[model samples]
Target: MTTILVTGGTGTLGRLVTERLRADGHEVRVLSRHSRPYAVDLRAGGAGLDAALAGVETVVHCASTPRGGDEQAARNLLAAAGRAGVDHLVYISIVGVDRVPFGYYRAKFAVERLVEESGLGWTVLRATQFHDLVVTLFEGLSKPPVMAVPAGVADQPVEVGEVAERLAELALSAPAGRVPDMAGPEVRPLDSLARAFLRATGRRRPVLRVPLLGKAYRAFREGGHLAPERAVGKVGFEEYLARRFGPDGGR
Candidate 1:
């Protein structure tokens, strides 16, 4: 019954969130950089943004930049949403942004802080890296026969589909400030995940873990990226892989 605007609607997560909302009989409008039949970029602020948000009851913001440099734009989005009187703002963030030194994470953290201070009804869920991100990260980085990762790191990779469902559920509820974090069913070594990913893709590789020093590696190695008791996702690493590499993995 509500009209919601979904940022980054063309992306992996945004698409699923929009689909779920639509299925629930809610009106779904997606914002993106390139205008599509169902997309618009919310970054371009002004009356234009106000117009885009007109009559919108909720804004599920998933739009973000490549690994780094998008903090200001994120701020702009939040401000514009407030100006438009958006009822709820749901932001998807990464796990360990607090402890990690990664530039992208800093941006996520900044926006999360902004949302908290804005006094808007808001929910921010810090999630572990996506299982799909694992595959994407290692796709061309692995040296074919050798899987390489920053050494001593651990991660709990959850599925994007799971994230989508959670976002949909959160969109319908009052802002929980921050939702119970979500992650995969099991925790796995970074090297193991890389190896599993390569193997799932039918690629032969010996995964190599290269040591990295920094808050990023330190936090990751110290288990900054797992949500064991908070996992609400249904797909496990193996299950995700089967969808991508099992005999029927090829669609």
Candidate 2:
């Protein structure tokens, strides 16, 4: 059995990746800060990484920092993997992160560069925003019956499970430079999406428009977040809404 080590195994996508790998009869180990029945913190150096990484054929790095200064983390893990002689390293990133000028994007891009320079066989799977965006927009846009967001923003959020499955598949394959960037089937306008979320939650707030400055907003407003047609994931907006909001749309 191929032993696979997954960092951030406690997260949504990471947990799913670990669970799916185990289900497929692969020997899967989790990297986490918390101690669990199956957990190891990647941040801790060699002693922190357990025997799971020993004789491991692959390492799937799902752990990440949102803001800046993750180069050290990448260096540490890549260095560890390099020492371990791991066969492949798979990294999960965000779509349009290169195009967007956010701090987090900068950090992700930095990691991308690290992988390229690390000399270990590697693959990167850039994914679109998650369904969690729906819930996030609901909370961010609310202001006591009135909601506001980028006037002309657009998005194509995919399911987190889809991303997890893709990562699992990559872990089973030989190291490839970059995988197909995954996204949802439908390209959704932020305005309508926000309204749908509010309606789904049985909220009576009216969504308002607010334009953001610079390329950050323009990239989002101009369809920079949609996935290539060939790379579209199986799930779409309506299907996800129905699953989360129910037929009548309520808890």
Leading candidate by lDDT:
1
For residues 59-91, write the lDDT of model 1, one tens digit per residue: 898888865546766677778877888989999
Counting clashing residue pairs in each candidate, in order, gives 5, 1
- Per-model lDDT: 0.81, 0.80
Residue runs of model 2 more than 4 Å from their true location after superposition? 37-46, 50-52, 67-69, 228-231
Question: Measured by C-alpha RMSD in angstroms, how accurate is candidate 1?
Answer: 2.1
| Per-model root-mean-square deviation over C-alphas | 2.1, 2.0
Alpha carbon deviation, residue 158, candidate 2 (Å): 0.6
lDDT, candidate 2, 1-251, per-residue tens: 88998888888788999999999999888877674644554545565563546787898898876644466677778888887899899999888878777778778888999998899999999998888766676676675667887888777889888889889999998889987788877777787888778777777877788887987777777766667674578887767877887877775
